[model samples]
Target: MMLIDTSVLISMFRDQTGRVAERLSALVGDGDLYLTRFTQMELLQGCRDEAEWLRLDSYLEGQTYIEATDLTWAEAARIYFDLRRKGLRVRSVIDCYIAQLALENQMTLIHNDRDFEVIAKLRRYRQTTLDTVRSTDFHENDQDAIL
Candidate 1:
């Protein structure tokens, strides 16, 4: 039903206050939670050690993983071009790819990145607000913050 973005996952694990955990628990009970291969790549790139890698991998293994077909990959580029034509941009191409995945699949994205917000505005897509725990992960500015 929803794709958990890497930014939100980072926040969930780093948040000492437990708010992200509470939200994640609710999502887990609400049908299926999903991850894109792109999100997996981004997350794995952040792991500091084999221990951290295994821990995160073990948790991610429980979620449903989604992949892009050739057509979908091309579609992602179109979305990028659409944004560029409009004089808009997100932080990364992967955000565009991830947005395309969620948009096509009709899955809401649980994210803590403003890139998703920008992508959402380009074409309607379901999104929820979340934060990167404290100040260390994502910017705290109201405009840049995401869910």
Candidate 2:
């Protein structure tokens, strides 16, 4: 399964004709796309008005959602401290929580942000960046590379 990060989702919502959106469209049909509660909150927070909020809220309802539990929170703290101790602190604590949530659920994170690069080094979760998707030739059988 794949966890669609806030960055990628924002791009998809803002630009339906963009590469990020195209990639998501190709992968979404597989029924493996997902979102974390943190991601949902981040997306909702981006809304400029009540109408945008309602539109986003309604769209998000179709996605598979995962909520963090106490265990998830505890582990996120550990990850935060560990990364800090290693001098690899992520830019956002919420990002740390999102990473932990994805790790706990064993989902590959799909994002357009570099913050996940640090988290990827410290965890076992997989991450597919927007650049990676764009560089990959999805036209041939190599489509599996993105899939």
Candidate 3:
């Protein structure tokens, strides 16, 4: 299974040509999709108005969202401190939580955010860029030029 991050979901929602979303859709189509609570919260927070929030709520009704437990928090704390000691300043607590979720679950993360790339390189978690996934398809050669 793979863990998806909020950045990829937001990009997908805002751009139809977004490779992240396309890959996510492909994963879902293949029955290999999973989501963390952190991702769900981030996506919900992007709703600007009540109507949008309701729409998002309705859309997420059947989705499964996983939460980071106490063990995950301990792992996140360790990761946070380690990254800090290495002079890497993660921008948000959410990023740590997202990374922790992927790490603790032993899942590969699919994200477009550079933050994930940094975390993957430092922490040894696996990650793949949307561009790389898109490149697997002949029709997706224009992804980089999309937006």
- Lowest summed lDDT across 10 adjacent residues in model 3 is found at 138-147
lDDT of 2 by residue, 22-132 (tens): 777676667587788776767776666778778878888888888888898888888888889899967777778888888888888787777788887887787777654
Off by over 4 Å in 1: 132-136, 139-147
What is residue 75's positional error in candidate 1, in angstroms? 1.2
TM-score of 1: 0.84
lDDT of 1 by residue, 45-113 (tens): 677777878887887787789788787888888888899999998767788888888888998888888
Root-mean-square deviation of each candidate, in angstroms? 4.8, 8.2, 6.5
**Residue 78, candidate 2: C-alpha displacement in angstroms:** 0.9
Global fold similarity of model 2 (TM-score): 0.81
Could you arrange the candidates by TM-score from highest to lowest? 1, 2, 3
lDDT of 1: 0.74
Write model 3 residue lDDT over 1-147, tens digit each, in one string.
678766666666666555656667775566556777766666676676778888877777767776778788877777778888899876665677778887877777777666666676678786665755442221211122211
Q: What's the TM-score of each model vs. the native?
A: 0.84, 0.81, 0.78
Question: How far out, in Å, is residue 133 in model 3?
Answer: 8.9
Using TM-score as the measure, name the better of candidate 2 and candidate 3.
2
| Model 3 spans > 4 angstroms off | 18-20, 27-29, 131-147
Separately for all candidates shown, the number of backbone clashes (residues 3 or more apart, or on different chains) is 3, 0, 0
Task: Give me candidate 3's TM-score against the actual structure.
Answer: 0.78
